[model samples]
Target: MGHDLDVLAARFGRHYPRWLLALLIISTMTMVLSSTSINVALPAIMQDFAIGRPLAQWLVTGVLAAMTSGLLLSSWAQARFGPRATLLTSFGLFLVTSLVAPFVTSIWALIAIRIVQGLCAGIAQPLSMVLIFRTYPGEGRGMALGLFGLGAMMAPALGPTLAGFLVDHFGWRAVFWLPAPVCILSLVGGALLLPTLRSLTPPRLDVPGFILLNLALFGILAALAEAQRFGWLHDATLLTGAVGLLGLAAFLWRCTHHSAPLLPLRLWRNASFRHTSWVSMVLGVSLFGVTYLVPLYVQTVEGYSASDAGLLLLPTGLVLGVAVFAGGWLSDKLAARWLLVGGLGLLTLSTAGQALMGTGASFWAICAWASLGRLGIGGIMPGVSTAAVQDLPAEELAPATGTISFMRQLGGALGINLLTFFIEWRHVAEGASAAGDAQAFVQSFWLLTALFALALWPAWLLRSKR
Candidate 1:
């Protein structure tokens, strides 16, 4: 019921060190930039291995899958190891992986290393939100996430630009090299800047439930990732998918009965948290799907450089920054319900416009529609973030934020991989190649628009506490 950060800050006094916050932001930016820096490197990766779209796509899916599985362990790790120790350990893992990734000869080896990198990277993702939850108050949570966003959002647009340049001039290895220093810096920052609040009362670990839920989530996502590569109609694919689904159902059912379940059924028991989380998931799906698809269209279809594709995305990123800040600031004062609705609606419209693009449509039109749809995402990002943090019990804030972030990551992983598959399938079904089929690109947007519509229900159903 009480404001968490205001209370903590008041206790720390006005002189609470600012560099700690700086470290958090810097570390977050570096970690994110490293992760995304690969988008532009995909072409190089494919060429190096002489692989196809599905295998190259797995480089991303594998990392996301690792992160998804890793999130389930964050709370437990933090509780046992403490925040700084956990963060530093994760950074160490990331540093090692990044340094080694570029030297591998085989695509399978690169992916194998990436899977390790994903587990390492996963540690940072949840803790960033958890830190803000622990350190900031209800009204202040928006400020924290906004500040966090400011530090990280640029990487999505910049990573490819930097990677493209690095690959064009130096090598793909340079792209991996870029983040290595950042990871070291994060380790240094984690040592000094991260807060040192020892867990006062650790939650009991539900080990059995944790294993069941984690395996189920891992199975389903892995199946989704592999489905596109292996024919979906194949007997093994159908059998594994059915088992994965059943496992997922069982995991959800078991969570309800466990005393301290991994997800905590109670978090979703809240009217707003439940709705907003679904919105977050749908938004994640739509956002990642588009992020992957658009860049590919520009670079592969239209034959632009990765740097240029990133530049094309600049307007959208800038507007997204504006929308996120505005939404967060307004969350405390305005009715967030309509804001959520309008955001999703605008997103749908923009995606719809993208779907109508012909083979020879104006290049600028791609930029316009992409920017428009993403602004909607920007508007909702902070609001959806605010929704859960605002109503939560002070103690549960960390877990809640971590869980929401995990959902977004999972959605991104699932959306991008699956949509890539869908785009290929639809093209093949039409007796076409994805490279030249403008209609295939349009069909890809159909899935994204449908996802935006799915987001609408959650945004509409979620009631603002204000």
Candidate 2:
């Protein structure tokens, strides 16, 4: 069987790597679109479920949390089950989950399904990077990584526009149905196109490490989710935060001590990986923070409809997609440190501009600011990803990619929750007028600007050579 699979891979290898990359890109776009496109539909869902902003926010939080947990297992799954089987399984689950999503009646049920959907997505995300790096030559890998970044970045870019249209015309349930066709196509293509290569000796799954990591993630998110209502100093909130911190500490210790750990802590010994990981976390915060806030602000404060708000983001998304491809191409020739500095610098400016928006801010103004921020993000993504793994040996690639992906998602999960809390707090403090809501959002953007600024120093410290 192994020999047969090797022959199959050789046969496919003759066709060039582009075909395989196409399939992987489509699969990635489908899953990522599922994650971000839903934000445009949140207002509609809030109305239907009769829930507040905080509860509605869980739809995203649940998915991010699940995705974060799922990423930790991706490298292991690929090592144990082979990349081909793992991707096929994830795509199948994604298809099934999308089919079931439209029928969910309760908010909790929807969150549960979103979690499962996220898990499926998590399984596929890291493999997208691993497979691409494995297939493409080192000379061209930067361009390949950029193309992959385009798809990954474009999903969130285009997701809101698509979801907005669906939500406006067919309602929120339609948003859930969007990924169906893409999933079907990916599953079929993956079955035939994915390389079948398994680990020689399957690694042991770190059950205890997995448990501690999840505990930390869940506890931190839960604490933040409830902090708006419970008060920060409340016993429950403090207890949950403490538990999460303790779990994180224990997990770190285990990774250092265990012979076969869930995450290899030694990966951090490389300065490039360490700096890139920090930038990745801040990028995650900035990326998701803007994505979440923009639609909500436009809808609630500016009185734009779901479709209108979604449309507002279309131009920014389009610009970001193009910029990502260009950035990836540039990564091959330029030093990553300069790219990171420029990108983060622009991101900070764009975010600061967003903080200056008032209730009377025009649609074009919003579009301009968002496009600028996304352009910065596109530039940062490919460079950061390429830099993170450039120094690692072949064997460390899987874990390094998985670990980096995990950090970004972890930052996303926490960032969104933190932004939500800030929004809620500011809304209460400023009072509940349209202008006041806009002010609260402005305050949140300022906070994001600070984060973006903080990320720049580390990004500047990245290796100066390609």
Best by lDDT: 2
- Per-residue lDDT tens digits for candidate 2, residues 1-466, read 6323446557777554777788888889889888888998998898888987877888887888899888888878988998988999999888888899889888889998998898888889888888887788576786777677778877876788899999989999999889999899998887777876688988889999999988888788878877887788999889988988899899989999999888788999999899999998887776676888899888987888889898888898789888877777777778888778888998999989988876678999999998998889877887787778878898987678777878888788888888889998898888876666778888988998899999988888876876
Candidate 2 wrong stretches, greater than 4 Å: 2-6, 9-18, 133-144, 233-236, 269-272, 386-398
Task: Report the lDDT of model 2 for residue 414.
Answer: 83
Model 2 steric clash pairs: none
Q: By summed lDDT, which 10 consecutive residues of candidate 1 come out lowest?
A: 1-10
- lDDT score, candidate 1: 0.73
* Model 2 TM-score, 2 decimals: 0.92
Write down the RMSD of all candidates, one decimal each. 4.4, 2.6
Where does model 1 exceed 4 Å of error? 1-16, 129-145, 269-271, 361-363, 386-400, 434-436
Cα-based lDDT for every prediction: 0.73, 0.84
Taking all chains together, the TM-score of candidate 1 against the true structure is 0.87
For every model in order, what is the number of clashing pairs?
Answer: 2, 0
With candidate 2 superimposed using the best TM-score fit, by how many Å does residue 166's alpha carbon deviate from the native? 0.4
Error of 2 at 197 (Å): 1.5
RMSD of 2: 2.6
Candidate 1 residue pairs that clash: 5-136, 5-137
